[model samples]
Target: MTAAKVLVAYGTKNGSTAGIARTIADALGEQGLRAEARPAAEVLDPSPYDAVVLGGALYAGRWHRDAVRFSRRHRRALSGRPVWLFSSGPLDASANKRDIRPVPGATRASMRLNAREHITFGGCLQEGAKGAVARMIVKRGGGGDYRDAGQIRAWALGIARELTDVTGGP
Candidate 1:
């Protein structure tokens, strides 16, 4: 079978989410899949890809507006293909397993895509690197980098496995 084309689309504030997306794309490539990581803004037309991985950095309990809009705009094309959604948030380790607050608009819009999975992972909190409100919150909350590279790689591998099952090869 021809290698499946996978697009890993992402949005980031301080670049952590972008890093995660790159890791995911790299993992998929290592598995002999054709994968490309691109920012949500630059990734036009989901129609060309066999699979799509949509991701964003969550801010104040919501995904980036652009990422949400991208998914909504390409809902039709995405629905006909395999889609996966992921969010980078919850910097507090204690908040890691907690259910992510509903991203109502994004979730509703993404329903049209019939996304196969939605994964939420811990993110990084970089002081002085975000908007005023976010900076204040991080300062008051005593921020830390909560991103786990190992966990991110594991999830990417799992997603690759699912893709292999769907496409019929490892």
Candidate 2:
């Protein structure tokens, strides 16, 4: 039997989230699922996929505007399906590996849609890629690329396993 299709939709400002989405999609594909990564704004409908992995970059405890918009616009359809949410913009300077909760916008949508999971990943900070406010924050927070590929791959694999259990994909 063919595996269920999964959509890995993401919203990004400096493109880190997009890269993460693509990496997740690739990892999912390796785990025997059909997964496609696309910008959340480009997806007008959530009807085509059996499962969704929605993610967005977080800034000051807020999700990207497009991701929030997509979640709101597709809330009805999304509620009926298996959906997962992720936040990909936390600076991991400290050793704390506690789960990062979704932003307020995402939390509301996840409640309405009953999203299955919400995972937060570390983000990257470039030299000159941020706005003035963000730049200042980065200067204060210290800058570096904090994304962990192994962690991301493991998360994607777990999601693939969950999808397979739910859909009985081959």
Clashing pairs in 1: none
Give per-model TM-scores.
0.89, 0.92
The sequence of per-residue lDDT tens digits that candidate 1 reaches over residues 30-119 is: 998899999998877878889989888888778877678888788877767888878887777743556554466457646867877777
In candidate 2, position 144 carries an lDDT of: 69
lDDT of 2 by residue, 1-170 (tens): 77888999999988889988999999999988889999999998889898999988988789889888888899887767888888888767331377776779889768877888888888877777568866876778666677888888888999998888887773
Compared to the true structure, candidate 2 yields what TM-score?
0.92
Among these predicted structures, which one has the highest lDDT? 2
For residue 150, give model 1's deviation from the true position in Å.
Answer: 1.8
All candidates' lDDT scores?
A: 0.80, 0.84
Candidates' RMSD to native: 1.9, 1.8
